[model samples]
Target: MSPQPQAAVGAPLSRVDGRLKVTGKALYAAEHDVKGALHAVIVDASVGRGRIASIDTRAALAQPGVLKVIHHGNAPKLPYRDNPASNNPPDGRRLRVFQDDQVLFHGQPVAVVVATTLEAAQHGASLVKVEYDERKPSTDLEKAKADKPTTYARGNAEAGLRNAPVRMDLTYRTARNHHNAMELHATIARWDGNKLTVWDKTQWVVGTQTELSTVFGVPMDSVRVISPFVGGGFGSGLRCWPHVVVAALVARELKRPVKLVLNRRQQYFGTGFRPAYEYRLRLGSDRRGRLAAMVQELDAETSSYEKFTENVMYAGQMMYSMPNVSQAYRTVPLDVNTPIYMRGPGFATASYVIESAMDELAAKLGIDPIELRRRNEPSEDESTNLPFSTRRLRECYTTGAREFGWNQRRAKPRSRREGDWLIGMGMAAGVYDTARMPAQAHVRLDADGTAVVDAAASDMGPGTYTSQTQVAADALGLTMRTVAFRLGDSLFPPTPPHGGSMTMASVGSAVLDGCNRVRQQAIKLAVEDRESPLYGAEARDVIVRGGRLHLNSEPARGETYQRLLTRNKRSHLEALGSFAGPAAKERHSFYAYNATFAEVAVDAALGLVRIRRVLGVYDAGRIISPKLADSQAIGGMVGGIGHALLEHTVTDHRDGRIVNANLADYLVPVNADVPDLKAIYLDGEDPNADPLGVKGLAELVMIGVAPAIANAVFNATGRRVRELPITAEALL
Candidate 1:
């Protein structure tokens, strides 16, 4: 069902909304118009942790256009109900913003100032002074002690290490990183007769609606969220943060629609970020290169108010076939704001240590890195004891090695070089367990032979709108131009959060179901109409192609869907499709695999590190759109380059404040930094996983990228940098 030149699916076509985005006509959250709308700015707490003594708003109220400043003192004590719909907020109790004076962390929202204009709101917020009783904050993870270590042991690590010949005890440190999606987080809220409507930049509209309902003590139905276009999310937009709630609260207090856009500086404090992680790996292997045992100690940061868990212990448990393995994963609650899921999350942190440590062992044993991994490949997921739904990691490595010319890599460190630049190639394997969630979509078939698919699913730069349109076109037997896909409105069908690379699998499945139903209904109508060709043919034998339905055996004897609809006196047909999750997922394991190869240059004396090229081979299973899949791949590689050589979120431990909150100070990979990057998805699909037979590609592209770069650095300079960013200072 590929359209020529514009082959709807698997074609390298650009975004359908590229024109609107480039022309600046795409309205983001703050860009939406609200009648008689006021602007709101948040006032942040000055102390790390303590109680708010007083909030003075006299000067702010005296300012021109300043309507009101809402703080805990004057704010209403609303009912914060328990909502288990979201798998968040353990024990069903959550943070009640503006309902109490307890300041949990620095930069906590203390008050919100509303005014006629954005500038007036900013000026008013600057005038609102907040005094707090400060307390000593614990921002250091090393100094903190854990109450208990979640231990897992399959065999005695001590015994294995004693009997085995080779072992390496290495530790890695990954700095905190912010998602830094180009568009700042913003929300526009309006309340009319106890009903709330918001245009918010969110990854999950249903989650936001539920959270807002809980906070405002309103019914979920009374709230509707809209987010049509998003610049980028990575993972920052996955959760509904407190700032969104503040926008609604301010709008309700002012009794006028209010738009609250987080300033550039506010993005650092306003949104969630990937927490810093410290991982220590002890790998024990035989002299022949077979893994004997693995032990990992992982510590990550979280907020004091809530328990945030990232499955850091996942990779060590299932990546290899080691019988003896033990992992102690602990979360150190810090005084900083709560952290949210980021790209690769726990797996990214663990891979840095595990992969780097494996490279070190390869160096010590004088074995090829690829050969070593192949020697230890697991037949099944060790942790779950279930067969993989689709595990082509081995194939990924084989194809990647051939395509990347991995065999050309030399064994001896510093063996490959040209003049002063030391060029070395390295590769690492990465894993991510594929996930599925329930989703719903509504598809409409028009009498004019055009179709429209509507869902609350968002296209946060991953081409959800375009990709889903392709799926609908193939399923509905229609041309790409005739089908229009619309998203980002709560009035549409419900959808899950767009993070974790699950949108394609989740939403695509829903689209398939909806379109299948619509097509079946059309087929039924055509057979009964007597106007359609081969009218008496069974519905099962009826096949549609190029917007026409007819018998598969006799293509010439067919009629256009438009003709059938018009002759049947039907104006349009609509179908609602919902893909419920599998009840027995344990029957088979599902995971996405990738093999990343990197070429790096390291200066012998200056220790300057530069990535020469990167190629990622993915076993994500049945790429829905090759063009869009490649886009996801390239975007991920760029993010990986940042994680390897640039991106770092620096915090001032003294005050528990982020130091370099702006992009100018905190660096990311630019065009000049990433020279040559490419991605290739293996041509295959697994029906056992889902109806779409598509595993996610977004996160897998970034999984082993840092390790590949790190391994390349080691090969070039003979220095194994377990810590991330493999920066010039670390090399020097």
Candidate 2:
């Protein structure tokens, strides 16, 4: 670590770029003013499983302003070198568009029409006619069958379940969820000879660069993915989807830049989504509320061409101290588009069922819900057999119970009521594995004493730009105003995907690296230069404050950064900081924990559960920016509300097509749905986690939120609904 300036790291500061967002000056992927960029529209497959039988581009090619049509028969064959690093595509076979006529699933990209205008391309896509020799598609998870299952076993669960005094066997279902970011998925591709420049909505620029390089068979240096502003990506933008490739293909064929943007309807089917899951759990516990054994069977939706599996059973193996455990997670590859990661991924789905089961056991045994969970908290991650870097779940439970007034919750259902509403409170524990990835950042101190920090990161509505600015301000000897942070472009230092709650811990460490390097360089220059005030001072004894380097004992005797740079005839100083990852240690367990509480008002007659208030208290290491962290917590809690009450992607099931593919049909949480929400971050930092002592918070905020609310609804009505979107119909 390099020496840095003194500024508050945890103080609540306003977003640095809030003005740009409110004024609409921030350039999203489609908003980038690319001149003369031809518009392109993609035509998706109407059938779930089929193959094109004949060529029918005559009508589309004849449309006014329609430049050309690219399909499987006439499109270029891309060189897709298997780069497993950024290709988080869990399924081995990547989706290759326009290279073959074999249709893998419904809504697969079949053809792309390029035109002089967007409207022309849109109309041209509608004009394209196709006939397919269709086959009966297996879109139903229960009906579709596969080979042997992936299994995990510890001690004999059969023997343990036999010896247990009490047991429960139940099944839970969660519907598919779309990302539905405010800004739709868009791509603008421009090719200059062999070099390609693209404006894309991506979470990871370096990852996107790697994937595009593999797709185009070009060197990594030849491709540049620039996206300075992203509206939001729960996990939808993690991979390079097919539309990005179509835009690039159209640009290369026409010898002109091409821009393709998916509308709200296209967004539902075009981008990836959270796979619907069917989980069956058989849990055995003693009369004392101690877990004895567990057996879990997990099945999720995937595409026919690939295998997509979520860590849906990860939390079950490690959360509680169970002696015997057996788990099997498998994917039912259906004739539907492949599912990508959502906000919480596997854990969110798993948490809902596991927590619900725990609540059930508490009810059966006539014990308090919190007391039941308190008896099962484990000391370490039993599955990995490795100590966590820092686990604070106990503190979360202790503090959250007091703050949310959990002690007042009634142990029996329908114990409280308000008019026609059955009022109740519920709380649940949350956990997320703090993922870390390698990232880099560049820092420079100009002669004017203002520092510039550049990294290939993004805000994504979580305030990455603002939080990183705070980190830089503290790392360098400057106020928030003197330090400027820039991100969302590949030209800056490379970074990983912005999801997974790892951005803060990974990217903040990188910014700390660069700022510390810059600060050290200034200190060395000032100490060695005879004209400096602290020329003879030891480097260790000198510290920076408010952009000035001074001695520890004598604060008044200092050298301004501008003075040192001007006298040395030095224009500026630069440094690059990076974090490779921490060495694995054995002493302490490491996991960020949260305690979420929800209050619901269920109408006894109508069976409609309306959330009135919600609160989340998190024990994530150190908070770099309080405001940004609060925003993350609130956003996550709001997403949780959506998970519990709304946000369901309904599939027609008749023809294996998503029936509600638009925002109007598919529901998300509206302003009226979310009323009072609160996020609280515990004041603490773990030295072992990273140089910045900050664990990521994006994913942690949304974990177990749905389960918490569902449990609360049960406390209100004594109705245990296993399926998600616990809609009015289910309650009724």
Candidate 3:
């Protein structure tokens, strides 16, 4: 069959839901108006690790409009059924809400106050008092003991290190980070007899449904989850948090709908955040700057109750080629909330250590940073011994370097200065696994010439609605406006969680399949009918454009969908699309690659760093939406700027309390911090990755950004600050 014309896929289209959003007509989770819904506020414990000694709720019960005050002392015993298949962390039991007097972390919910109004709920919550037997919590990551180390090794790293000509050992620390999405973590849950309905701000509706069903000991069919809009996730909403269960449990007890919204401060403890990491890296390289061995020791923070682990060792095993590699990754259990996947998750953290180490090695060997990376580039994925599905990193580097004016950068540190500012450029190579999971989508084409495609996916500011609509419109041979995409509902066709940059690769493939089948059904009907203009034409030879089925050989031989369906008395055409994920034994190692460049100016006297410019060249399979891809890339770089110089979540080791839990205390990059930024996608597709030909872009864009900025800082001021959020004190 002839390839579909490139009309919508690569086009820079505006978001279809922009108008609805700007007009404030789009409903988010907490915005849903549930009549007679009561408000619930949780009372947090003062101590981190302790046992509740006494609870006094008499004063709260006396408050007007207060419906009920429930605590562990009086709350009913929940089923708390185990659900390993859910997004819960592995090996450890999830925190059972209001099931015991034990306090695992500071700000743990000790009790809940339900009131007829939000104001009353707040007043009641403040009136309730709780006393605890406090214990000194081990919130400090450095002091906590790490669990059994997970090890990975290739050749003998010790022998390789001993034989190498040059070596360097470095230790780096990254601070904890919060998601801090625009919208609060909110849920409105209502129970009708045995059935439960919830409107939540979440990334995965089906996952939430399954979690809630399992938690309440109810069948999955009895739970319905809806989330039409999300302000932003960045990975915070990936799991169903404890507050969601609290809302549902309270609603079931009161026999009325309950609305619970965490304030900005409560969000810090209510939702998951990126864990702090301590990484020690040792690199052995030849005189030519070729990596001979790499030994990585990693320790990350996690909650005492759950074992939360990410792929932090992945980049060490595969990012750059090395004859010998060894890794040990351990999670240090602390009196804190369980960590969850943040933006780039493991790849972003590991890339910072590896990429920065590579830059250091380049300086030690007196070679250009880009040249050093090029020297160690492997022909295939050495870790898996499989050829890459699409490895255009060389092209990305060349393009990014050229476009970023790499030739202007001097090899020496602090070579260029403007007044008190020293300018420098740095670059890094990034890789993220191209992951695709089984997904299903449903596409329906009505006789009115409009279509709707449904999938249980999420947008989360990545333009899933616009991109999926583009895919469906092109596949069904319709204009972009004629097709509508719907998501974030459990009733829609099931899809993988809208994270890990896999939505386009997985859900989009299913959308393409379904739309094609529906369009093919129409062509089949037209070609088989004797009265149709496309009669007797081969199905492959027939193409649909603007809802008209026409012979490819003869453009004039065609009929509109309205004419054909109206004449045949067919109401609509529908089909279910699906994509089977990777096979048991994969033929290729699929990964998205990026070459990220950054220019920074640092004030030596003041220890202030300013970003001059950033450029990211991506070899991310295919460009689904260029405009949206640009937004994603720019946002990723801005986030990296925050991670490099602005953002940090501070925890007080004395009592295990988050010192800076609000936005005013914790900082992120603002418009002033970001200057000129550009994103370039190498024009290409990887048929081996998925049907949509898109490698994940969201996570890939963020992976190498921090390292690039950090490397630039080193070049600018001749300061190699190993810790993230390189404050002025470290630079000075």
Per TM-score, the best of the predicted structures is 3
lDDT winner: 3
What is the per-residue lDDT of model 2 for residues 644-715, given as tens digits with 9 covering 90 to 100?
888888766666677888888888888888868888888888788788887778888898789999999999
Q: lDDT per prediction?
A: 0.85, 0.86, 0.91
Q: Candidate 1's error at 345, in angstroms?
A: 1.8
Model 3 lDDT at residue 158: 87
> Tens digits of per-residue lDDT for model 1 on 1-732?
222122466666677787889999999988998889999899988777889998889999999999999989988887877767774553213567799999887788999999998899999999998888888777776776543566777778767866778888888899888888899999999999899999999988888888889888998899999999988888888777888988888888778899989988788878888888888888899997899988788888777776677767888999988888888887887787878888887888888788888888888999999999999999988888989888888899999999999888988888878777788888999988787789999999999999999989887898888899898988898887889999998888898888787888889999989998998899888887665675787888787787898777777877888888888888998899888866564688888989999999988778888888899999898888888888888988889889988998877777777789899999998888886888888888979888988888888889999999999988988877777767888877
Sort every candidate by lDDT, greatest first.
3, 2, 1
TM-scores of the candidates are: 0.97, 0.98, 0.99
Q: How much RMSD separates candidate 2 from the native structure?
A: 1.6
Q: Is candidate 1 or candidate 3 better by lDDT?
A: 3
Q: Model 1: how far is 363 from its true place, Å?
A: 0.7
Candidate with the larger TM-score of 1 and 2: 2
Model 3 residue pairs with clashes? none
Model 2, C-alpha of 46: deviation from truth (Å): 0.6
